[model samples]
Target: MALGKVKELVSSNPVVIFSNKFCPYCVCVKQLFVLKLGVQYKAIELDQESDGSEIQSALAEWTGQHTLPNVFVGGYHIGDCDSKFDLTP
Candidate 1:
């Protein structure tokens, strides 16, 4: 179920970020995409959602990444902040 939801979100959005509100890395990733790159993205703040843990678990299983700020671009997993920075610009 959570995996299905993750797939739907990734397919629907040009960019999707699974984040935690208080994580500095999440904040940085969002700012880089939304502010620096001027790209629009759907940010799912796990700490604020009821099914956040399940969603995160699904994300981990799907991406093999167990970290906040899990990013996807154009339906492709873009990985963490460093990965994003390396790919961008």
Candidate 2:
């Protein structure tokens, strides 16, 4: 997409995870990556109205599934928290 938009997303520390603020799986993912793994990330809660409509639209366009906890790392789609990280276990 646009470089400016991408820059906006990655403006966080290490990564950015788009979440729903309700899903337990999403919480687990963040805890694992940030608290446990010691990685820093700015999480976006989609269920909240704080973010603008453009961000919601952009998220739908990128992931194609309007589900909670859609993730992004370095501005790249990494799927949801559980599926993105643990495929074997």
Candidate 3:
């Protein structure tokens, strides 16, 4: 739900999930953040077929390129699951 389909509600909490309409990996990513880690966050879904979306813009701002399942914490883009593994340290 990008391109105004959803508006990001800013918060002091860092962890977040960049999701899409039908992605199992994204769902798992969100689960790990919420269920496993018990972290709350802002979930932004990208509209992949609508030419582009705000998610892409955010990706351009926070990261160098647009990618799905992008996660952030502590105001830093820590990437996906692999990056999250680094966060544990």
TM-scores for all predictions = 0.91, 0.66, 0.63
Q: What's model 2's overall lDDT?
A: 0.66
Candidate 2 has a TM-score of 0.66
- Of 1 and 2, the candidate ahead on TM-score is 1
What lDDT score is found at residue 30 in candidate 1?
Answer: 92
lDDT of the candidates, in the order given: 0.92, 0.66, 0.63
Q: What is the C-alpha lDDT profile of model 1 across 1-89, one tens digit per residue?
A: 99999999999999999999989999998999878999999999999999999999999999999998999888888899666344543
TM-score of 1: 0.91
Steric clash pairs (candidate 2): none
> Which pairs clash in model 1?
none
Q: By lDDT, rank the candidates, best first.
A: 1, 2, 3
**Cα lDDT tens digits for candidate 2, 42-62:** 877767855535566777775
Model 1 regions more than 4 Å off: 84-89
Clashing residue pairs in candidate 3 are none
* Least accurate 10 contiguous residues by lDDT in model 1: 80-89
